[model samples]
Target: MCLQIRDIKSKVIYCSAVLLAVMLGLGTRAYGDQLPHFVSVHFGDAIWAGMIYLAFRVLLTRHPLWLSLVLSLCFSFGIEFSQLYQADWIIHVRSTTAGGLVLGQGFLWIDLVRYTAGILFCYVIDQILQY
Candidate 1:
C-alpha cells in the first residue's frame, strides 16, 4: 500500500536534496567543457531530470512515491515535447542563458532515455533511503 508523508523531518530532508540537486546540476553545466565529451553532453540532462525528481519530492512530500515518480516523468517529458513548438517568442526565450538551460534548445531521443534513467535512479535511491 502507498502511504503519504507529511512530516517536518521528511520535508527538510527532501528540501535539502532538492537544493543539492540544483547545485550539482548547475555545476555540471558550468564545467561541462572540462569533462569528457560523453559525460558533458549527456550528464547535464540526466542531472536536470534528477533535479526534477528531487524537486518533486519537495513539492509532493505528502504524496506517495509512485505519484512523485509519475508526475516527474510527465513534467520532464512535457518540457522536452514542448520544444517541438518553435514560436518566435519561445525561440527567443530559448536563446537566453536561463531559458536555454530550462527549456533546452532542441530535442533528442537520447534525452528521453537520459531523463528516464535519471528519474528512475533517483526514485530507486529514494525508496531505499526512505524505507
Candidate 2:
C-alpha cells in the first residue's frame, strides 16, 4: 500500500541520517588528533554523542524524543564507564582501530558533559525539523 511505502521511505531516510552522523563522527575523530588539544579532545566526544543519539533514533523510530535522548545518554555513558575495565581481551580489543573507537582508551568526566551537549543538540535539531 502507499502508506506502507511511505513508512518504509521515512525509515530509510532516518537510517541514512544515522549512518551519515556515524560516518561524520568517525571522520572527525580520525582527523581530530591533529588539531589543537582542546578541539581534538572535546569535539570527538560531542560528535560521538550525536552519533549515539542518531543510533537511538534508528532503533526506536516511534519512541518519544525524551526517551530517545535518555536511551542515548545511558548508552553513551555506559560505553564511557565500560572503559574502566581493562581486562586482557578488552584491552586487546581496544588496541585495534575499530575497538578503540567504540571502547575508547580511557575514562574522562569531561566526556560526559560532551555527550550531554551532543544529545541536547540532536534533540533540538529533531524538534526544529518537526515544525
Candidate 3:
C-alpha cells in the first residue's frame, strides 16, 4: 500500500527546493561552457523538470505526490511537444532570452527521458524528506 505524501510534505521545504532547482538550472545554462559536455547537455533539462516538480509540490500542497509528479511530467512533456509548432508568434517568443529559456527552440526525444529521470529523482527526494 502507498502512503499519501501530502500529509508529510512541508510547503517551506518544497518552496526552497523550487528555488534551488531554479538556481541550478539557470546556472547549468549560464556556465555550461565551463561544465562537462554531458552535464551541460543533460542537467539543465533535468533540473528544469525537477524544478517543475517542486513548483507543483509547492502549489499543489494538498494533492498527493503522485499527482504532482504526473502533472509535472504532463506539463514538461506538453512544453517540449509545443516546440513542434512553429507559428510566427511562438517562434518569435522562443527567440527572445526569456522565451528561449522557458520555451525551448527545438524538440528532442531525449528531453522526455531527462524530464522523466529528473521528476522521478525529485519524487524520491520528496519521499525521503518525509522521514
Candidate 4:
C-alpha cells in the first residue's frame, strides 16, 4: 500500500513538473521585460520543481540514484536549450538579467553541474529526513 501511494505521488510529481515546464516556457515569452520579477520567481520555482522531482525519484521510488540525477540534469539542460525558440517576446525576456541568469544565454556546461548539484542536494535532504 505504501509503495502504491508513493507511485501515485511520483506520477503526480512528474506530470506537474511537465505542466510547469510548459507554463514557464510560455510565461517567459508572455511577460517579457514588463515583469522581470516574475521571471526570477518562475526561475526559482523551476529549480525547486526540479529538486522535488529528484527527491521523488530517490526517496519515493526504487529508481537508481545516479539515473535520477542524470534525468533531472538532462531535463533542465533540455529546457535551457529549448529557450532558443525565435519568439521576439522570448528574446526580449532573455535580454533581462533574470532571464539571462535563469534561462541562460546559450548552452553552458555548468548548468549540467548545477542540475547535478540540485539533485544531490535533494538526495541528501531526503536521506536526512528519512533518518
Candidate 5:
C-alpha cells in the first residue's frame, strides 16, 4: 500500500509537470494578441498546482502537510509578485516569442484569485489521484 501510494503520488507530480508545461506553452502562444484574463488565471492556477505537487514530493518527508502547503502558497505568490521587478533582462526576454507569452507584464488582482483557484484544484486533483 505504501509503495502504491508513492507511485500514485509520483504520477500526480508527473501530471502536474505536464500540465504546467502545457499551460505555460499555451500562454506563450496566446500572450501578445489580446488573450483573455482566464488565460492568466489558468497560468496562475497551474503555478500553484505544480508547486503543490512539487512540494509534496520534495518536502513531505521532512515537513508537515500544512507547512508544505504554506510553503507552496508562498512560492506561488512570490513568483507572481516578483514579476513587478520589470528588469531590463526580463523585458528583453519577454520580448522574445516564448518569453513574452509566459512572463506576464504587470500584476493583476485576478491573478491572485487564479492562484487560489489553482491551489484548490491541486488539492482536488491530488485527492482524486490518491485513491
Candidate 6:
C-alpha cells in the first residue's frame, strides 16, 4: 500500500510536468507572432520560470514548496546570468533553437522581474490547489 501510494504520486507529478511543458511550448510558439511584443516577451519568461519550478517538483518530489520555489528562482536566474558570458562554445550552442530557448540570446534585468512574477504565479497556483 505504501509503495502504491508512492507510485501514484510519481505518476501525478509526471503528468503535471507534462502539462506544464505543453503550456510552455504553446506560450513559446504563440509569442511574438500571435501575441503582442511586451506580453509575449514577459509572459514567455514567466512560463520559463514556471517550467523551472515544475522541473524541481518533478525531480525532488519530497521537497517543500518554499525550497522548490527558491531552487527554481536560483536556476532561472543562473540561466539568465549565463547569457552574459559570450564564450565561443556557449555562443555556438545558444545559436541553436534548443539552446536559444534554454540559454537565451542575451541578458536583461527585466527577465529577472519576469521570472519572479512567474515563480510567484506558480506558488499561488500551488497554494490554491492544496486547498
TM-score of each: 0.90, 0.86, 0.90, 0.43, 0.57, 0.85
Superposed by TM-score, candidate 3 places the C-alpha of residue 25 at a distance from the truth, in angstroms, of 0.7
lDDT of 1 at 52: 89
By summed lDDT, the worst window of 10 consecutive residues in model 3 runs over: 1-10
Question: Which of 1 and 2 is the better model by lDDT?
Answer: 1
Task: Give per-residue CA lDDT, model 2, range 41-117, as digits (tens).
Answer: 67777877887887777676666778989999999999999989988999999999899888889899988999999
Q: lDDT winner between 1 and 4, please give it.
A: 1
TM for candidate 2 is 0.86
lDDT of 1 by residue, 56-117 (tens): 88877878898889988999999899999999999999999999988998988888999998
Model 5 lDDT vs. the true structure?
A: 0.61
Candidate with top lDDT is 3
Candidate 2 stretches greater than 4 Å from native: 1-3, 33-38
lDDT string, candidate 6, 14-104, tens digits: 5676586658656676666777777766788787788788777777666677888899999999999999999999999999988998999
Whole-model Cα lDDT of every candidate shown, in order:
0.86, 0.83, 0.91, 0.60, 0.61, 0.81
Better of 2 and 4 by lDDT: 2
RMSD of each: 3.2, 2.0, 4.1, 7.6, 4.9, 2.2
List of clashing residue pairs for candidate 1: none
Candidates sorted by TM-score, best first: 3, 1, 2, 6, 5, 4
What residue pairs clash in candidate 5, if any at all? none
Query: Between 3 and 6, whose lDDT is larger?
Result: 3
The residue-by-residue lDDT of candidate 5 on 88-115, one tens digit each, is: 9987887786664455566766766676
Flag clash pairs in model 2.
Answer: none
lDDT of 6: 0.81
Per-residue lDDT of candidate 4, residues 75-96 (tens digit): 6767666665758887788799
Worst 10 residues of 1 by lDDT: 1-10
Cα deviation at 42, candidate 1, in Å, is: 1.1
